[model samples]
Target: MSWNRRSLDRPTRRIALAGALFCGLTSAGCIVIDDAEARDEAEEVREDLRDAADDIAESITDALEEIGEHMSDFAEELGGETLVDQPIHFREFYDFLPERAGNLRRTSREGATGGALGFHMSVAEAEYEGRSGAEVEVSIADIGAMPVIGSEGFVEWLDLSVDEESDRGWARTIEYEGYPAMEEFRRTRGDRGRAEFTWFVESRFVVVLDARDVTIDELHELRDAIDTDALADLRDREGR
Candidate 1:
């Protein structure tokens, strides 16, 4: 009878030990799996952030590139000594074009990317010699609302696009007539052009970039800017 009892106790002890060991291993495995999952999630989030930053950087670079390219092409057509600069500003936003490349005319003081009222720094010749076909025009200003009403209006007024490749959300015509002052009106207005910069938005306002070599009426036919649909789409997707 004693032997039987001992035998039964031994089997019970073994069963208890086996169950405890199994439960402990399962718990440890669960903890390991949880830790691994957390690490993977963190890695994914970091990668996403990096990708977003990269896309933004790329988009900004592309916009600047387009500006530079257009300026270069226009300068080449003028056939004169040209100077270019990246950093330029008026009382409002960053002046995208620092100076008129070939003619060194009045700089367009359009609004900034963040919605601000822009002022024309100076009024001068509309087109450089030999560069008759080049002029930057703003056609739309659809920036969101802001605290200052003037800023919003200015943003809408100065959102000019000369590069056809950037003609996705805005209208920018490049082939506008920049006139030389005719003798018929010399007595009244001296030497000035009838150039116009068409605003293609809800509120149509012609913000004249210069009143010297161009006329407001002649600038009505400025509609040659090309639409860079693919480039613009890529930029939009990148969130620029």
Candidate 2:
């Protein structure tokens, strides 16, 4: 009898050899084992091992999927509900801006698409009349599909101070209709000044108004003109 020892592992080879020896001793006459029988036994062992490996792989994959689901649930519980998919209309945000404020006219209007992570965002830009080389640019971004940025979180992130000597802008946190907001102002050389006001609505949408060669009063007016409640509702309803 010829045995292909290399076809099997050490333990399997030993078992096969033992079985063959037992069969030969129990059988009548000179027992003759062919290579085909050895090969068949080796193939069966390989199939069993492959089946076990496949089962283990499937179990691991299921476990990973379960873990991912649990993590997503935990995140939602900690960070509030996530927003849903919805198309944004830039004109809706643009309408929030006054058609005309004093001498500043709505010179140009445009919209752009932007977002981060798995979130969706609508960016609306409106430029106002400029004096000399300065103009006021207002941009409103309606972001969806993100965790809520609560007022407390906003306060922690809004801690910033101004550097007057460096002519750099300063930021101070404020509350607008019960929502956290920030305003910043900076002035460089003659007639070169900038101001910005930003506020988040329902911890989702954000409105930003920036001005060049404009006063803080103008920026305040722009901020006041926006109906934040309506804007917040817009985002909320769309998410639903």
TM agreement with the true structure for every prediction: 0.24, 0.55
Q: How accurate locally is residue 99 in candidate 2, as Cα lDDT from 0 to 100? A: 78
lDDT of 2 by residue, 123-236 (tens): 566678645555676666554544433324333444443323344656666777877676667876553578767777766676767678876666666667778888877755
Reference-based TM-score, model 1: 0.24
Candidate 2 clashes between residue pairs 3 or more apart in a chain or in different chains? none
lDDT string, candidate 1, 118-212, tens digits = 21111111222213433443222221121121334333323433432221122234422331111111111322333333321212112233223
Please report the candidate that would top lDDT against the real structure. Answer: 2
The best candidate by TM-score is: 2
lDDT of 2 at 221: 64
**Model 2 segments more than 4 A misplaced:** 1-81, 114-117, 148-169, 189-192
